[model samples]
Target chain A: MADDIKILAFDVFGTVVDWHRSIMDEVRSMHLDVDADQFALAWRAGYMPAMQKVMSGELGWTLIDDLHRMILDDLLVRFGVTQLSEEQKRHLNKAWHRLGAWPDTVAGLRRLKQRYTICTLSNGNIGLLTNMAKQAGLPWDCVLSAEVFQKYKPDPATYLGVAKIFDVEPGQVMLVAAHQDDLAHARACGLKTAYIERPLEYGASQVKDVSPHPDNTFHARDLEQLAGLLRC
Target chain B: MADDIKILAFDVFGTVVDWHRSIMDEVRSMHLDVDADQFALAWRAGYMPAMQKVMSGELGWTLIDDLHRMILDDLLVRFGVTQLSEEQKRHLNKAWHRLGAWPDTVAGLRRLKQRYTICTLSNGNIGLLTNMAKQAGLPWDCVLSAEVFQKYKPDPATYLGVAKIFDVEPGQVMLVAAHQDDLAHARACGLKTAYIERPLEYGASQVKDVSPHPDNTFHARDLEQLAGLLRC
Candidate 1:
């Protein structure tokens, strides 16, 4: 069994908030003349490639807020919806801030917070995470971000930064993420890793293969299950 | 009127937690043969000079935790209490982490958090702030520290760092502190300032002549009053 973990750093987009459904709902509410699900998927599709540019040193440090805006601008043109004013586009880009939490998010976080310090170690910028926490009622002890280190997730700096913030060895901090790649990177940095199965993170029609993999220290179906497994 | 402050960055020591009383209580609990109040005051008197060393570039950036330890060592000798082992000294030095919040702190913070994104802009390092928040049930949206900025409080970078973290303009963020110097420094950096008077911050019988000088945008008796003044 793992020793007592002092800190639990979470991935925000899928694990804490249901980004897929929330983005789709926002697209639908905007009454944009396009497939909301497709729009959501297309926008998310731009995420990894954008981070790869920075990760590969092809681009200088860029925050998730700016990247989100860039993707939103391209997405608006791709969806053939040019009626949005600059102000409206700005507001639309902030949809990430208003994303709803997953069903298990609040209760699980509350339980986990009882036993350990919980924080967000997401690729999301600090501003975005802070706003999301306020909007979604997620009880984070701190909203740490890649923005603090000027690097994105899967980078050693971002993973190690969490440990540094809490002044603990990396082994004492656990990364709770939905993505295998993120957990893998954190594990490589000597941090404990938990893989949370956000099966429908892509959308309902796209059923994810939720088969267990052996790379992580803990695996759970949702935040609630993760909390239970952590004995919180 | 202040233009819809979204983030409230608080000063921690005397604002959120009663450090004087907490330290005195801890010293008393240890049954140390010394005046608890005097011991507490002596330890706190070391705080400013230590922070000034970093602020004035005399000392390379040092965290409050380490500063506290340095002062703790001298204080032990000054009080002629050499009975504590090294491990015991270390544990006792971390009393700052377990400080009890003022009566209205938790409830007021909860209320403020309903409307504004609340965080700690403390000279305390992230580790100390995180542990203190966990112990005291202070529901912070994030814990921004001087450690993050690599500069202590009253520094423009530390004050502006809070604004930068939230990607908001300085004027849109408010610094809630009990100290006049801290508020003045924040105001100089264009951040809104609120002074919460903690009359007995030092100790009840010590006769602290706290002047209600009008240097800040708002002044209140305590966190509860501050919450009401902010209409949170």
Candidate 2:
């Protein structure tokens, strides 16, 4: 399955970057009067529903950055944190742009990049991904996003778009993601899938299930292990 | 004019990569029964007319790779060089992906990237830019292309789209390119413009005029000089 894969498209949020920890740290640094873990989880939780709104045409062609701001506005009210000025609120919403990579992300990506064309196939906007990469030294060959296809994940377009962009068959592109549903969709679209275990993706209180799925072409504990498994 | 800049969007073909020399070298290596210089010039000469076809809606939206291949096929026939196999033709068409970076390209980009977000805003496709960056060690913070905008350079949409993607005002972005026409178009879209001198872009036999335009915010001999001018 790995032999034919020339491009490795990664899922960014939980797969490549430690978004939960990053947001929690940012909340702490800003001295926000709220539970960081809960705030991070709440913010992330709003993501899928907001994307669904776009997918359903309730919100027409909204960027992740805009969707994120919309979620932040509601969260600020629910969390009773009304102290921020507009500039502070905008900066806080841009926390996604300053996300920290997982411990092994940079090194593993550097190794994997030597062999495969490594890129981000994330729902994050281009600016978010680009800034995150620069801050975290992600070393992506390309930064592709839902913004590029104007369609979020689970849409066949996002998965197949990677192959189309590279002028290769879908089989030659591999989706390396932590989410089984994402992998399932990519597999259904005839792309190879690699499951990456991001157990602490939701922070210390929540340990995600890291069990192997039979459908995935490969599975590993983290990017480092994935690189080793790929013999990079 | 430079004070507000947050991103540096670049033109890739002749500005970042030595396409003419690279193509000439490839032609020589292939041992084609044609003059290397003539072959290189002929191939590049087809580029604008081909893009014009796409712009005029005669050919629909086509990727630069496909456009390059079409041009190569025509050149092979025009030069009476029909001995190449399909595989050879395909490989030769990908020479753009292997184009050599100008000597100071990587170092200069690295320096500029320290102070501003540096990205490609080229007519080349994503795959081509990504492959070229991987091969040439270009230190672009993001690999962007006309493929993302679905519009070529000099198009207002393409110039304005970079600012939109980065969520910045057009004035916050500086277009760094060798071509005055590209810079002029970018300036018209409210982007700051920096012109780099690429005297031999067409080859040593045909020197490109590198005279300064007063409308440009900055002008330099190369990327390294541009970096110095920006105090990066």
Candidate 3:
């Protein structure tokens, strides 16, 4: 399974970056009276449903940034906080752009890039991925997103699109992600699968499901371990 | 014109990499009895026509790599070269992936990337551009290609697509290239245009049209000079 892999497509957000911590920190700094942890969770809670609306054809194709903004507006109303001006709301929406990467992201990716083409395969928009890379010094050969394929994660088009872009068979591409559903979709689409353990992805207080699967081609404690396992 | 420009989109073939010289080098190293310069010219001469076929909907969308291979096959027949095996032919087609950059590419891009978002806006496919970047060390924040927009250069969609991807106005995005035709198309689409001089782009012996145009937002001798002019 590992022999032919030429492209290692990554799931962004919780896989590569500390989104919950990043969002919680930003919310805490906002001095909002609501529980920052719950606020972060609330903000994230709308992500799947928003993407589902697009996936189900109930909504037109929209960028994750725009979906995120819509979610932000709903969250603010639910949390009973509406003091932010337009500029402030815009800036707050851009917090996704400033997400910090995991401890092993840069060095491990630098290692993995030596052997495989490294890229982000995310639901995020191109601008968000590009800005996040710039902010976090994440070196991606390409910043591919659901926006590029016009479909969200779990969509076979999105998984197969990465392979088509590289002119390689889906078996020659590997999906490295923290989510089981993501890996399952990639695996179902004939790509190799690697599960990355990001224990603190949700937060210190909440548990994230990071169990291993027999079908996974590789498993690692972190990106550094994966790099080592891949002999990069 | 440069004041509001937040993204610098680049043309790759002649502007960033000397394709003529690089192809000539590879052709000469192959020890074919044909004139390497003429062969290189013949190979590139087919590029625009092939893309035009796609643009005119006479052909389905094709990647530059495949188009390059098609042109290479015809050029080989024209030049009376039939000794190459399938493996050799495949490797030769990938010569585009190994083209060397101009001396000032990496450093100047690094300097410019410190402020504005820098990316490739080329007709090349994603795999070709990604492999070329890996081989050339071109630090692009994102690799935006004609493949991404499914339109070749000089098309309004290709130029305007960059602005849409970044959620910016056309005026806030700039097209930096060596070709007058390319810059003109970009300017017509309302993107700021910067013309860089690649005097020996077509090979030292062959004269290329590198004349300046008044409509260019900026003109510089090279990427280093462009960086200096932009105060990066």
| TM-score rank order | 2, 3, 1
Candidate 1 residue A226 C-alpha distance from true site, Å: 1.7
Where model 2 places Cα greater than 4 Å from the true spot, the runs are none
**lDDT, model 2, position B162:** 93
What is the C-alpha lDDT profile of model 1 across B1-232, one tens digit per residue?
Answer: 5546878999999988999999999999999999999999999999999888888988897878889999999999999998998888988899999999999999999999888888899989888998999889898988888877787877799899888878889998999998898899999999888988888889987655557767688988888998898887
> For residues A1-232, what per-residue lDDT tens digits would candidate 3 score against the true structure?
5668899999998889999989988887888778888888888889999989998999999998899999999999999998999988898898999999999999999999999999999999999999999999999999999888888889999999999998889999999999888999899999999999988887888887778988999998889999999988
In the range B194-229, model 2's lDDT, one tens digit per residue, is 999999999989999999999999999999999999
Pairs clashing within candidate 3:
none
DockQ each: 0.74, 0.85, 0.84
lDDT of each prediction vs. the true structure? 0.88, 0.94, 0.92
lDDT at residue B66 of model 1 (Cα atoms): 89
**lDDT against true structure, model 2:** 0.94
Clashing pairs in 1: none
Q: How displaced is residue A51 in candidate 3, in Å? A: 0.8
A1-232: candidate 1 lDDT, tens digit per residue: 4556888999999889998899888888888899999998998899989889888998888888888889999998988998998988888888999999989999999999888889999989878898898889898988888877777877799899988877789999999988888888999999998988888998988978877779789999988998889887
Judged by DockQ relative to the true structure, which candidate is superior, 1 or 3? 3
Better of 2 and 3 by lDDT: 2
